[model samples]
Target: CRIQRGPYRCHEKTAGFNFNYTDDPNYGPFLVSVNGVAGNNTELTFWELLVQTGGNGTIIRPDVGIGCYIPEPNDRIILKFTEFVSGSHSVSGNSSNPGNLTAGNTSRLDSIELVVVNNISNTTNKTYSTDIAFRGVLIGAMRRLQTNSGFNFTYTDDPNYGPFLVSVNGVAGNNTEKTFWELLVQTGGNGTTIRPDVGIGCYIPKQNDRIILNFTKFTTNSASGSCTNPGVLLFLVGLFFCFLI
Candidate 1:
């Protein structure tokens, strides 16, 4: 609602943008067009909702839409006009609505376990339950843990890669030592583990997901080590940005 309301409040006072929207009773407000460019289904085009995080120019497409998204201070909202291939799904105008975000098949569990592990020193190892919103981003849950569970963390926002986990608690990663925190997750009935391609800013934690922050290093020429190849890591990160756009 702020996206729709802010312009009217400040249009006469400062430099701003204009937008058009429709108020759906069930989903609230949804963006129809921005700055006069509209999306047409016949043309396979739609308005894509994205945000550039405050202080950094790293852009990310949120899981929620205008109705539920609360922009933080200094956040630059982006309404990109995009076209998608037929038979392929995209995060279009309708897909970002509240109905698609919180409708049927959404997970029931609202809490996830976060395990912090220091593989190098093995000194600091603890777990906390991060209470999360339905389909909320991981960073929100992490902030909640820092506020309520005595957890502390810091990240470096990469212009190209979004937020990179720099440290957890008081432990910081060193570039010279080639050590950094790796994100992993365990899900499903048999506890299948996986390393998420996207970083904290874009990754949404699932119900009962066991998130593991393993402090480790990239091995030199080792095929079996975690994050064995830096090139592969970059490739995955590229895929993440491509999918979001």
Candidate 2:
């Protein structure tokens, strides 16, 4: 792939890898290639971009990446290659304040980042961070991450609880058989675990929050908790009445 970054340009090609191509239905194709070298053919140091601007030189992150953005004749596509102090957004590092693009213009990257990990899989531990809109429910974030970050998540909408998370990357959390999707949150660097008080559709995420959706077993004792079962309770109550008679 040929990439143009400002005055520098290069052609990058890789086999058996799909990281460079991000295809969207509406926006066409955009390139997020990481292999572009300088015109001198040195190793390309940053992610590729096709930035659309308002001619004030303020560049907004493209609605999508290269494979998804079909260019218009009048559109300004700035090719910028930059590095991140923290390469964790999966594709983004420390972002230079999108404010550097200038004021009064809404062309800025306004997204949040969340890290996802699954304890159920035995595969090599690979790390990926999901970057999505600054404001949205957890399901919305999951959809965005599924597309951009190359992770898989599935859910079902229940009339009672709204959106119930079914699984992550093919690992299902069964609620009836005593298995569940446990929600764990870690804010800042705190080592303690905080269980969320809300469901996926109701909970909103804060920046820098590590969200762990774990598939785990229910810990209720069958003897004590079985009393909550209507069938068992009914049978026990009938026996109590017989004793009184």
Per-prediction backbone clash count: 0, 14
lDDT of each: 0.58, 0.41
Candidate 1, residue 25: lDDT = 31
Model 2 segments more than 4 A misplaced: 1-126, 175-177, 189-192, 220-245
What is the lDDT, from 0 to 100, of the residue 245 in candidate 2? 2
Residue 143 CA displacement from its true place in model 1, Å: 1.1
| Sequence-dependent TM-score of model 2 | 0.41
Model 2, span 90-205: residue lDDT tens:
32211112211122232222344444444545444434566434433455566767886667877664322234566666767553554445556676455455665444544455
lDDT of 2: 0.41
Give me the candidate number with maximum lDDT: 1
Native-to-model Cα distance after best TM-score fit, residue 81 in candidate 2, in Å: 47
Looking at candidate 1, what is the lDDT of residue 59?
A: 87
